[model samples]
Target chain A: MHNAHNAKSILHKISRAFLILIAFTATFTAMILSPMLSVNVNAYTEKKVYDYGDLLTDREESRIEEQLRKASENCGHDIIVYTVKSLGGNSVSEYSQRAADGINTDSDGSGILYLVSINDREYDIYAFGEMYERIMSDRELNRLADDLRSYLSEGDYYGAFSEFGKRVEKAALNNEDYSGNISVRLTLSFSTLIVSAFIALIIVFCMKQGMKTTRPEITAGNYVKNGSFKVTVSRDVYLYTSVSRVRIQSNNNGHRSGGGHHSGGRSSGGHHSGGHRSGGHSRGRF
Target chain B: MTTSFKCACCGADLRYSPGSGSLKCEYCGTEFEAEAVEAMAEAAESDAAGENINWQHANPQTMENDGSTCTYSCSSCGAQITGDRTLAASFCPYCGNTVVMSDRLEGMLRPDYIIPFKVEKDAAVAKFKEFCKGKPLLPSGFLSSGRIDSVEGLYVPYWLFDAGVKGRVRFRAERVHTRREGDYNVTRTQHFMLYREGVMDFEHVPVDGTSKLGAEVTEAVEPFDMHGAAPFAKAYLSGFLADRYDVPQETCRPRADERIRQSITSALANTCRGYTGVRPQQQFISVANGKIAYALLPMWLMTVNYNGKSYTFAMNGQTGKFVGELPISWAKFWGFFAGITAALTVILTLLMNYFG
Candidate 1:
C-alpha cells in the first residue's frame, strides 16, 4: 500500500512538473516572438571556393580520404575534404604566405595554413601534416609521428608538439636549453599537492577528537523475560515447603568457588564528551 | 523472618498433633518420619549447593493433582493449560483446558538467583479480578465463577550476561555550492576516514535458555529486574512446578549479542549526526561476554477465554509490571478497521484533488 501511494505521488509530481514546464515554455515563446524583441544583425561576408575535380575517379578520391583520415586520427580531430582541380601547379607556399598576410603575420617567408578549426591542437596537426612529412626526411618524420601519437593518447597533443618543436630549435641552437612552456605541468603538480594536504588534515583531526573523549560507560541492558507481552508464569514457590519458591543462599563451602576479583585504578586524560561546542567545527573562510 | 514446621506432603494449616513425633498433614492424615523430617530441615543449609549446581540432566518429576483440577478447551483458543490442585476450576479462560492429564514437573538447569514474590496469592487473585472488570468486551460469565486455580508459586530461570562492545563506523557527508548562472556544476566527492575506537558497555542482556520454549514466547515477557536478583535455592521453587535449563549457556549467548549490537548501533547513530562533512565512514563492533549469572523471577500468568479465543496475561511478581493481550471484541475491531479505511480514502481523495 505504501509503495503504491509513493508511486502515485511520484507520477503526480512528474506530470505537475511537465505542466509547469509547458506553461513556462509557452510564456517564453510569446515573449521572445514579440515585436519589441529586436534581432541583432552584424555585418558579415562569405566567399565560396568551388571544386571541379574528376567526379568519377576512385583512386583520386581514395588518396584524398587517406590523407584526411590520417590527419583526423593522429590529431584526435574531425577533418573534412573537398576535391579541387589543378590550378597550374599553384604551390602550397604561395597560397599559405598569402593567407598569412591576410591574417597580418610579420614573417614574409614563413607559411601559415588557414583551416577552419574546432580544436587548436587538431588544426596544428593539419598545418604540420601538409609540411612536416613532405619537407622532412623519413627518419625525422617517423620520430615526430611517434611523439604526436603519444601526446594525443595522453590528452596533451598540443604540449607534445610544442615540446618537439622546442627540441628541434634547441638542437639547431647548438644544445642551448629553452624552457618554452611549463604552466600546465606546474598547475597539475600544485593542485595534486593541495588535495593531498586537505585529506591528511581531515584524518588527523578525526583521530584527535576520538582520542580526546573518554566518558564513563553507559550500558543499556537487554530485556530478560521478553514477550510476556501476552503470557507468562506468575507464582511464587519455595524449594522446601512448596515447589515454586527458589532461594539463593550464599556459599563459601566449595573448594573451587574461584574468589571474585576487584581492582580500581585512575588515569589522567582531558576527555570532552556528551555535547561539546559545535563552535570548534568550522571551516575557516579564505 | 518467619518459622514453620509445615507438612511437606500436603500443605494444610498445621498445629502440633499429639502422639506424632514429626510434622503431619492434618487434612490428608499423612505423617513424616522424624529422621527424614530432620534431614529435610538440613536441606536449607544445602542451598549453598544450588549456587553453581547444574540441573541439565536431572530427571523429570510429575506433579500430583486431584479431581479438583479441570482443564478447559475452546476451538479458538491458542493457549496451553497446566492443572493446579483445586476443587474449583474455571473455564480455560483461553481454551477451556479440556485435556485432563497428569501434571508434569520438568527439571533442567537450577536457577542461580531469584527474585522472591512480593505480591501474595490474595493480591494476585484481586489483581486478576480487577483486570477482568475493566475488560468490558469479555463475556460477563468468564470471571464470575470465582474459581482460583492453585496459584502455584514459581521461579522462572533466566541468564544474565555483561560485556563490552567496540565498533568502527564509516560514513560520507557532502556539502554542495552552486554559482547558478555561469557554471551550474555540482562538486560532490566522498571523504573517507577510519571511524575507530568507540566503546559501549552492555548489561543484563538476556538470552532465553529453555529449548522447549520458542524465542517469541520469551520476548513476550520482556524486562525483568536483574539488579534485585538473589542467588537461587530449591526452597524458592516449593509449591510451584519449574523447568530447568534445557537450553545451554553458550547456545543463548548469540541472542544476547544480537540484541546488544542492535542497541549499540542506534546509540552510535545518536552521536553520528550534527557534523558538517561527517557521515558514517565505517562501522564495526565487538562484544566480549562478561560475568554470567542465572536468575529466577516471579510472575502471575493466567489464560483467559473470550468469545471464541483465548488470551493470556502476565503480572510481574516483583513490580506488578503487566504485559499480555486481552481478546478484542469483533464489533469494535471491525468498526475501527472500517473507520480507518474510510478515513484514509477521504484523506487521499482530498490530497489528490488539491495537491496531486
Candidate 2:
C-alpha cells in the first residue's frame, strides 16, 4: 500500500522549482548588467561628446534665461553679454570655469556669456558661429560653448574655455575631431534615457499595487471565498474592481469530489498627459 | 444471490451527474434512469441503513484518557485525546485508528457529495517528504518512516450559508485647475457616486463547530478538498476515530453568518472608483435557507514528540493535501535569520551610498 509514483504531484513540484529558478536568474542578470551598461554609456560619451537635444519646452528655455540674469546681477560677475541659444537639439544647462569671451558674436564686442540653464542643470556657453564651423564639429562646438559658459561662472573663463577652443583649433589644424561630430544624436540619446526611466517606474508601481491580493475570509461552512481587492492610484481613488465566486454543493454519495471555480473581470481608467497639458482620460475594461 | 447492474451497451458502471440529471456510463457513453435503479437498490439500502440510527445515541464509548498527556476528549467515547495547535483532530486517541465518532459531526447538514481520494497515502507521504527534504533547517531524523503513526478518516463540522449583501458608500474625488501666474497648476475635487453591484459566490466555508481549538489554529490548517468529500457513512468511520463537537450547533451559526456579511460589504467598497474617501453608511446580509448536515470525511493524522513539545500534522484523507507543525531547529533558524539580515543590510548600505 506504500507504492509512490504520483505523476501529477511530481510534475507540479518540478514546474514550481523551475519557475523559482527562472525568477532568481532574471533578477541576478538585471543587477549584473546594470553597472556594465552604465560603464558602456560613459565610455561612449567620453569618445563622442553630445548635446541635451530638443526636449526642453520654450518655457524651460526662458526660465534658464531668467535664472542666468539673476545670477549675473546678484553674484556680481558683471556679465558683459548674454546669448541663450535654442540650440534646436543641443541644450546645455550647467557651466564651469573657462572661456570668458570670443563666444556668440565677438565682432559686436558682446560675446562673453555666462549661463544656459534647463530643468536639470545650468551650462556655461560660447558660440563662434559660421566662422568657426569649419574648424569645430557640432559636437565639439556644443562642448566648447558649454565649457566656456562654465568657465566664466567659475571665474576661470580664460583657462578652461580658452584651452577648449585652442584644442579645437589645433584639431582643425591637424584635422582629427571632425568625423564623430554627432551633437544632435547624443542629445537625443540622453533625453530618451531620462524620459524612459521615469515612465517605466510609474507603470511598474501601478501594476504592482493594482494586482495586490488580500487575505481571504474563512466562513462557518469550511468555505474560504476570496475577499475584496482594490486597484487604486491612491487610497479611495479606485481605478478598477473585480469579484469571484465560490460555490459548494451537497455530496449525494461518499465517492464524489467537491471544488469551486474562479472567473471575474476588471476595468481601469486614468489620466494621461503630454507636453504641458492635462485632463485627457482613458478607460479600459476587460 | 448477488445482483449487479452494468450499462447495457458497454457493460460499464454508471454514475449520476447532477448537471446531466442522469446516470452516465464511463465506457462507451451509455445512460440509465435513476428511477429504475432506485427500485433495484431499495433492498440494498434497507440493510445498510441500519447504521443510520439516531446520531445522538450512536458510538457511545466511555471516557478513557489516552496515554498521551496532551489529548482532547473524543466526542463519541468521551475519551481524552491529546492534540496540539497543529494537530487536526481525525481519530480518537485511545483507539489508535482513523474513525469519525458521532459527536464531532453536524446532526444533519453533512455533505451529500465528495471527490474521492485520487492521491494515495504513499503519494501524500512522498509530497511531505519532498517538502522537508532540502529545507536546511529540517532535521534529518524527523521524517523517518517509522515515526508516522497512522491516517484518520473524520467528518469535520462546517457551515454553508448564502445571502445577498448590499451597501451604500459616499466618497470625494479630486481634480486640478491651473492659473497663469508664474507657472504651475492647482488641484481640486469633484465628488461623484461610485456605485457597483459586487456579487460573489459562497461555498463550503469552514466555521469551526467546536471551541476546543482557537480560530487561528484552525485557519492555519487551511485548504481542504471539500470536493472529494463522501456521503455520511459510519463505514468510513470504521478505520478511524471521530469527535463530536462540544459546542452546540446553534452556537456556531452566528459566527458563520458574520463571515458572509464581512465578505459581501468589503466587496462593495472594492468596486467603487475615483473617490477620495468612502465610508459604509448602510449594510445588510441575510442568511437565507439555513440547512445543516453531518458527514464523515478523511484525514491522515501524525504526531511527533520533540524536545518537550508535541507537534502534529494533518493530511486531507481524500485529496492528500497536507498541513502540519514544523519542529523548529533553533540552530538553522538562527542561521537563516542572520543570513537574511546580513544580505538585506548590505543591499541597503549600497543603496544609501549610491543615492545619498
| Over 4 Å off, model 2 | A1-286, B1-119, B139-146, B162-185, B190-203, B212-230, B274-282, B337-356
Which parts of model 1 are misplaced by more than 4 Å?
A: A1-286, B1-108, B121-153, B169-194, B211-217, B275-284, B289-291, B305-309, B336-356
lDDT of 2 by residue, A1-286 (tens): 1223334444554565455545644554455345434411100001111113332345544444444344323321212222233423433321211222212212222112333333333444332222133333445545555555445456442344235434443444354322243343344334443454455445434433322111234533345345522222222322212122333444567865643111111111232121111111111110
Per-residue lDDT tens digits for candidate 1, residues B1-356, read: 22234454555555543344566566777656554345334332332232121112212233343343333222343332333444233333323343333343221344556777776767777766665554534433456545446343444556766655554443333333332233233333322221223556655666655553345434545566767777665546544434345466766665665565555545555554433455442334555445566666676655554444545555667776555554433333333333333333334333433563
- Whole-structure CA lDDT of model 2: 0.39
Docking class of 1: incorrect
lDDT score of residue B85 within candidate 2: 24
lDDT of 1 by residue, A1-286 (tens): 8557545655664565455545644553343234223311111112111113333245544544454444333332223322223323433323322332333222211111222112222222112221222222234434544555555556542344344444333332231111121344334334433553455445434433332111212223353233211111111112122212223455768688553121111111333222121110000100
Task: Tell me the whole-model lDDT of each prediction, alpha carbons only.
Answer: 0.41, 0.39
**Each candidate's interface RMSD, rounded to one decimal?**
30.0, 22.0
- What's the TM-score of every candidate structure? 0.35, 0.37
Question: lDDT: which candidate is best?
Answer: 1
Q: Give the per-residue Cα lDDT of candidate 1 at B224.
A: 63
